[model samples]
Target: MSLSLIDAENTLASPVCALAGRAALRLALTILWHPQAQRIGEQFIAAAGSGDIDVNRFAPLFGGLAGNAQALGHRRIARDALRLRRHRDHGVSLLPPQSRMRVELNGAMLAGAPVRCTPEQVDAGLVIGLGGVVLLCVHWMDRLPQASAIAAVHGVGSAAIRVRELIRQVAATDLPVLLLGEAGSGKELAAQAIHQASARCRGPMVTVNLATLSETQAVAELFGADTGALARVGGGTLFLDKIGTAPQAVQAQLLRVLKTGEYRPVGARADQAARARLIGASDHDLHDGSFNQSLLRRLEALVVRLPPLRERRCDIGVLALHFMQAWSTRTGSAPELPLAFISQLCNYDWPGNVRQLGKVVQRALSAAQAGQPLAFDALVPGVAERTARVRLGQLSGQAVLDALEANGWLIRNAALALGVSRPSMYKLIGKHPAIRQIGQIAPAEIAAALAAHGGDTGRCAAALRTPSEALRRYLRRQAAGKLL
Candidate 1:
């Protein structure tokens, strides 16, 4: 209906014309401008000759009195002032003149406000005002490799595709990326994909899991007592994993650095600029009152939420086969992953996410190595029992009501019967609005049981052999709350 598609109809005879014409139209769309600007854009495009672009190169149009400009051979991209060259790992950077290059990121000034430049870079969708014409800064990674890799890791699900697309969209900019997901949901893989696809791929991605750090003092080992960690990264990416576990002191330090790009080491007296691009990952919802709100705001320049495994079950087989094939290649020979076995995996409610899937795959490989056949039972050693436990775990609204009744509205004993902890027992009590026991249970008996179990509902729940969460929920229907 629009101009480009109508033009495409005129070139139906030649395959090459269709392709080439479409590409030109795409380029034209990308450089849209108004009356005066359109004239300049046309002059710019004619001088630049087609404005055909490559992922690895950029060509400059105008030059100042100091020097003549040269183009990088990887791709012929249009621009007025900046010539960026892509390296295999370090990403792209300005080719010449060695002058300060300032970038306006969606509005914020990124580089030229006295911040020294580096080889590592990232850009999301950036609008650039070049001379009298306008342009968009495409993210450094638009190729298929990043897309295919994400699919292999996450799956073929629409969720995976959307996440991959998000990664591609943001990988090129200097924006801080925040990844939120359940444990083992491949947040790290997503971060890696961003780094690999960005202009910063050439630089090292230094990863530090705050949860794994022993204590506040551990910051010195990674961040240093002097001004060094971020400086050392020098245009690379610094990944902060499990950011929720950061000690208050560490949190304070992170807040300072991320806010102003000025950080002092654990013992350093002076503040220095951080050159490393930051990427933070957490399984927890960072905005919850528990974590520092200020830190969350600074770290979450761009937030990406990953769908848990249960939400994307279709990806299970794709990932399973991918893992099997990769392992087969690694070991030179491995058993084929049967469709039946793959289907068995797809049916699971993977609480542990992709991490659990990889572990299951590894276990399957081990079983095959020992001459054991791959099957549901072989791979899932206690599949039947786990299934039984899950069944028991799923007792419905009525079951919760009945359990409370049998336990005589005593939150403690009811939890015990349901194999749940006291706190869990109390929660179960709350969920049953009609099952109030505020005065029903004898005080003396409640006291006696609390004294007997030392007030440990977990101990009581264990004796009953029931999951705490289910009982906790139904009992809580009387109240219905608590962080799960």
Candidate 2:
């Protein structure tokens, strides 16, 4: 479908919009890197009343940087930026530092390299932000199909990055691919990505959910009497979702096609050549003798196992932000997400994986007021308590101490790292002899820590293993006493 035809109200939530936002951000960053970048910013600020660009066609993309610039009375800057984008190659090159960092991000994402940039670095402008990096990486990796078959799969963690690398590697070949993952773990997305990245991307993609087809219906639906999926997906991709659920007879037929590159229709006298590349996905372990082992062996030529959402908790923040933006586009009202609620999201054991988390985010938005914090407990009901209980059960006294030290004694941060609530972290600390509460800390110790850290409250808090706010309050009381 043409992104230009999509309603402006809904485009922000669409994959097209997400891609456009990335493009706009990259363009803005590039302009910032240009030697005449300051002039461009001034021009955008100067031209506050230039005629609007086609909001219907270019708005989703230009609207990101251009629209924002216009809102700030810089219509000329927006217009110039758009013009520059149309002829971006004119002498523009990213600075060496930014270019090297971008290259590192690409390698980390598509080659499974260990390179990473912390948020601090991104904020300091030492490198592009993670969102920008990921978008550029995907754009480079996917190589721009006329239209993407699916939304860009979003992940930043090592597991997700490895999966992206595998998809890129496997897409270069025509061998059958097997996707193994829990339900809603993005197997279908992976299949689509493979098809879009493959040589057969120009062709059609036909999907058959085997779980929905019975034995009697499988042959007719798949191999068709006149023209089945194989016939319809000529020189393209045929994705069989829930492959483990395929009937025994259908499994044999699929094996024949995979092995000999041919398949017979339900009642055809002769077999036909199968040209479509096959991609099979399943949540089941097919090695238990129930599934066709021979067929399994054939489909396993390239295996990609999608990790569950819980295993990649590091990606939860970015994923949540994506879902929230989608929600905002759909509803036209941006809801604020509190840090505690985000911690709650990371701590919860999402049994249903990424799909479940997305649904919960939508529900939370629906239930929250325009100005209120999104209540995690109201929507999820006991998730916080259950998560806290589970996390506390797993932690010993020494484990709590180790977590606190590892996080530089930031209770909230340490709590999040250990998948427990702040209160639970304090409770665990109370039970540990090695750990001391702010109240238990002597004034002399606090004074000594402050002196050692050159009177930096933050450093003193870390050194004393106490909360900064409490330390600040204690110092305030001491100052008052000296004044009296």
Candidate 3:
């Protein structure tokens, strides 16, 4: 039986594909990146609309060199066979001779993301993973779009898309640019993208963090006759990282260079015109009554702001996939980051942002190569403890005890409520030593252990599984209540 495809939707109508990602633009981007999926999706949609599409006529969607040609397809696909079998749910029809596309999953992989089983009913915009794997249900109402040449660059989020557009717009100009964001928030990468896309794409790009260099060193590097970094960046791009940290004196010199575009090299009598365009970066807000005003004004000619990873959690899956592939290409070892790991990654509040994510991926990669599933403890040191702290604050004492008893005092099981790891759960137990003695000892004995610790929260917390600070706060609260 052939799946129907008439009067279908225009955009990504799949709930799964629409999952929290608004930056992917059109699912067509997914198809454009992987030609095989495009070809298959297109063929299946075409045949299904014809009213007599047969599953038998088409070979397996996968296998064969033509089908695996980077796995691209959809509307323009001809050779790769895409199948659609008529799915009769409970031997019933839910339509008036209407059309619908019934998609089936064959466990096709997308980067390292897990492919979810297709639901009983498939519609438009049903995306699979960050690997550009998508299932589209085309109709007469649908329109096939062209692939964006620039969309192929780094990000797959809406914010990233805008940033890329800005880069492309400004890359042709010679104006100085300022990038503002948190550390490891892709400012440097954006700068490089700018350099590569600019008219000076053929020239060299050099980066130096002013924060890393001494005041004297930074002056020598930037203005001291354009000898070292200045000489190296000769006719290309000079990326000054952590520009806010540059000394005031150096800022003044930089301002002069920006104004005149000429600096005398060390030991050189004549001044050389600065041909390299300047790109400055800062993680902190310079306008917050801190940075040098003159320098800030000069560097504020063109600005691009980057939102942190936590702000765009939707891209975490794709970023993780990209990081893994990049590492594999660099180290020549393909390490897998399954769906479970990507889910955990999305849940985390990465204070260090993408840099931290990269480091976590590296650690996980090392463990994965050795046959270890991505462990919570590997990603975080006290995952359980940190999670439990906030949750325990909300839970009543009886609720905590009930959770402990339900888990049979299994710290890891209890930690599920705490949203933490096993190690953190154990720490939670220390905060309430009575929890550790549950089922093994009587209530009287638990009190005796607490008393024997000399009301020392640290000792009692260790025996109990509580934070010493928390116990101290509790005692102070008790004392205040008594006075009241």
Candidate 4:
């Protein structure tokens, strides 16, 4: 029998009735096939029960189903239905509340909403009947192609705990917001999330890279220009990235629009309608005096600064695994990420930040595809291996001498050869035992290494990549007759 209940009329009917009906259907299927249907029903019950609600009343049916592995071919159909039912209602509710959605649309003036959470965000208890079906849709959506950028630096580790709270606050407000972070820090993604949660999500979210536009063009673009100028954007949002670089004239024009919902297009003499909200992002010189103070004041309506990757080291492994899996799928190659590779990534300074990290991972994936062993050489190349080979306890003068001799005495040429500057080279060489023993790895030897690396400091540093620094310090103590 088809189960139908009055959704709007019987407002007081509890969800328990729906649960009971689903349970009855499973029991009927179990009875028809005895042990076979019983096992399938049990699996369904267990999976469903794992979620928030109690589907345990079906346990008797499940227990009956457990032992019939044979003659159970017919049970597959029954089990499939049960699995579908359970999956739809599984876990936590992932989407923002309707009220929250409404607020985002009207209060915040957001553009369109794109689902951002993973399948894990779905809530099991809040959904029933059709809600369960929508949950499956969320799972399917998650499997679709997504943006290739890494998750925000803040999305990893302990930082994630704090960020979730921040996300709540940022999403709740409709104020003009500014995101500050180093380049490739995922500021744009965060802005999207905010827009998704805000009230204007149903509208269009237009993005313009203010950094790429000329001063005159930016003005015309931001505020609709005259007859010749681009028409003003209708009800929607405008995302201005690298607004710090927006020219002074553009800033003045932009300020006018923010102050009064009016803007003229480039080369246009007349102002036009302005209904779009503004979201600005800046990675450089945001705090410097060179940026227009008025523009800063306007954008700072609400400011959120994203932390760097080095500050959130604990998330490196998780992020690396995620990226590795993603790239593996992209390359159609099953490449496993070794724990050691992740560990090495954690120790680096990450000067280029997440962008550099993505490049490193992509290169590693490419190398693994070429049938090479997954090694640190693929990421940073040479350093981890050399460090492992040298086995230096502390960085010291003698250690420098060892590496210098290994490479031949070349100083000016050598320092330039390594990614390290001349000062760092001198510092490394002076701290080692070799400085006193052979008077250092001879500047010329260092110079030769630099030359060999083609003056690419990164490459040279990789060539001399050893944990000699630690061993050098210990050696110095021993040489000075200062025993602990």
Candidate 5:
């Protein structure tokens, strides 16, 4: 009995080597991050040489290390290890017998043996064994960041890691921060993270929704009638939600404050020095000419774009688990989340993003009966159908082209718009006779489009009906003299 390990890069390691390496990595992560390190260490020692791979033979060595780390009171390490362990357990329970699993670095299962288990059965970060066949899906455990650092921003995917790094980078600066993302996509969370990480952490963090305030009340609410948000947020952070919806007057006032670090309160004769660090968030495209350019420019000095939940599908499992843990802690009811339900969550295109997902998790937990796995489909009608992968065969070439053009030739966005997976969208584009890839377009044509669009890659992409990224690559190669 041997294990098959296919990593994100599609690299396959020898069965014995893969098992040994994976076990070592999981153990190391457990020691550094699991809360029940002592117990997990004991289990690791006990399970040595128990499975067909007999990879656990090295567990005792690593398990002892976890015990020592736990005894030293490293809470962060224990928490992360516990997260990885849960993910691995979930993944294994969904694995099919005698099937190779192709997994992404973020713990997303790309491909699994359909004969043994349907695509619906596969999950993220798994491990399971049946009759000498053991499937380990703990490869992502090694990539887990320090749990304490990210805190409220829960995710284990590469996208999440990038967001965390960006937060860390921007927190060191005092520039006005702009957060861009869809509604319910955690823009507020990103803003909170920035506030928590900044030097103003000790000061009050104030949040105001510009959209909720009327045009007449905007000035009074933001700057106040002698004493408002600006004064209230003194030396702290002022987070403006839906800044895109702000009226022209408010925008002018904000721009003045950003430029001169001074703003006059409503009905005030003199201007006061602004001490609060400003953070603006919006779901709308600020460049759409609705927002003031000066204000947008100032706010965007340190911008952080939060990826939508659909774009970070790999993080769905861990996020769901986080929500579940929170719900359980609040209600004292630990309802089980079925692998099938988690798979459904991963597959679904969450238009409302993380906030929406959290609500779904809450609803499921509330409706769940004792000792039964979460019935996601029952909680949300047509969820299974909506989440099911859309086959390319079901769509017309015209439909694909329409989706592509509508989304500015962005593959991922077009896929989401069409309710199809990215891969399926790619296949649809490839098969369409009207749609052309960057490679198929003549360099001269691209050059002309670039000129017509005034060197704007986005405009050129729309004009040429190709992906902006691919067009950029072509331009880069041409500039490097790699393409004629």
Candidate 6:
């Protein structure tokens, strides 16, 4: 049967081409069938092709190069061919009637032509046809590994399985995306990923931290000054980070940009210039009024919330392994993550999020270089006790006295050692009579005592621990005796 143009194009559209020249050839051939799909694909390739390359130059000559250029370039092409061969070898076929049966059937059909096959023959044919379709699908599926290997050879992450759906969704739109999460949640990374997946990936991505810029500076920074020089410098994307902390005026400036795609920088009186794209990020809750409401609404066109590390604890082990491999390759060291260390990392609440995890891994690597094991203690400092906060009210008189003696009656520093603020510490020391008495002691004598004790208070106190009350009573008695 002669193939219709629609039939030809439909079969050709199954494979998405990689080589620009080959893709153009396929499109040119398809135009004979359905001009529309071919024309659309042609225009895209024409726009992408630059310099000595054009559709006319590549279309007519692609077929002479040999067995499907795609098959030759893809790594598992041989394996796919083998699988197809195997399916053909194992595939069952419909049987033709023998000569005697053919004569009997012809005589019967002459009496009443039998147009339908027997039930067994029909069932067998249906099963074989279904098997062929399934095997053909398997052949195409097998080509996926070759494409993935090609991607790997080009230095791309093999996270395609996980990120494919998200990537596709992000690419199909030009909306302003707001990435929201806690600090170190990789909002910036997500922003770039979305930008890369979008149509504007070819453009640059400019990032500015709102927290680092003051109110006046932020306005000037986002909307360039009237001078065309600053505005003309960069034109890709304006990524605003920590949008929650951006001042009210800056938020207004950004909102204006989102509305109009234009901005006039700080100190500029010139008209606003249009921008390529706007992607914003926030480590704080902008929807909760941590940021300006109007600004949030303007950017709410597309909001992507990233879960914190604590919430996605299951991904921690995989993430940790990735980090370890990356660091090891960069530093020329062997991978050193032990199961116990990974367990602690997974169990811990990553308050700082991915940033903290990366830092811990780096620290662990450094420790390993210095002859230490890659353990949790080496990775994190003060993991058990983050900090100590004390309550002086809970201490007894004796305990208070003991603390005072331990600190040598230096109330300010003593309070620090005891983990209380300076003012509360002063109050505690002021209530002790011994502390007051120590305060009254002459500075010279105290210095002398300190020198004598070599700064050991207990030793000094044991030598001169007399009560002030007794000293006063003895002086009064001695004065009365002298008067009599």
The local lDDT score (0 to 100) that residue 351 gets in candidate 4 is 52
Comparing 1 and 2 on lDDT, the stronger one: 2
lDDT of 3 at 449: 58
Task: Give the alpha carbon lDDT tens digit for every residue of 142-244 in model 2.
Answer: 1111112234666443355567767877898999999999998989889999999999999999999999989988888899956689989999999999999
| Count of clashing pairs, candidate 6 | 10
Number of the predicted model whose TM-score against the real structure is largest? 5
As a whole number from 0 to 100, the lDDT of residue 136 in candidate 5 is: 24
The total of clashing pairs for model 2 equals: 3
Stretches of candidate 4 off by over 4 Å are 1-156, 224-233, 267-269, 329-333, 373-484
In terms of lDDT, which candidate is stronger, 1 or 5? 5
Q: Which stretches of candidate 5 lie over 4 Å from their true place?
A: 1-148, 370-375, 381-484
What would you estimate as the lDDT of candidate 5? 0.60
Question: What TM-score quantifies how close candidate 6 is to the native fold?
Answer: 0.46
Task: Quote model 4's TM-score.
Answer: 0.48
Model 2 earns a TM-score of 0.53
How big is the positional error of residue 408 in model 6, measured in Å on the Cα after superposition? 54
- Compute the lDDT for candidate 2: 0.58
Those runs of model 6 whose alpha carbons end farther than 4 Å from true positions after fitting are: 1-164, 226-235, 386-484
Q: By the lDDT metric, which is better: model 3 or model 5?
A: 5
lDDT (tens digit, per residue) of candidate 3 on 78-124:
34233322222101011111122222221122211111111111221
Cα lDDT, model 5, residue 338: 51
Candidate lDDT values, in order: 0.52, 0.58, 0.54, 0.46, 0.60, 0.45
lDDT of 5 by residue, 1-484 (tens): 1111112342222123244654433221112122331222111211212121122312222323123311223221111111112223222212222323222212133223211211122222223211121122232333323223646676654457668878988898999999999999998888899899989999999999998999878888888855589989899999999999999999999999999999988888988999999999999889989789988888889989998986665466567767877887887865665544554565566878999888988877766644445666766677645554333445667667665665557665555445456676677777777777898888899889989989998778988888766888888887889645
> Model 2: how far is 299 from its true place, Å?
0.9
lDDT of 6 at 50: 14
The TM-score between candidate 1 and the true structure equals 0.50
Query: In angstroms, how far off is 1's CA in candidate 4?
Result: 54
Name the lDDT value of residue 214 in candidate 2: 90
List, residue by residue over 1-484, the lDDT tens digit for candidate 4: 2111112322121223254443221101111111121122111122213232222112212222123322223311222122222223232212222222221110012112211211222210111111111100111110111111223433222244344445456657767788888887667877776666667778767778888888766665665443222243355567788888888887787788778877666555776767777788988866678877877898888877766665544344445555666786786765644534543564444656677777888887777667777666656766544543332333345434433443333443333222233466666765654244323345475457669977654344445543333224434664588554
List TM-score per model, in order: 0.50, 0.53, 0.53, 0.48, 0.57, 0.46
Where is model 2 poorest over a 10-residue stretch in terms of lDDT? 136-145
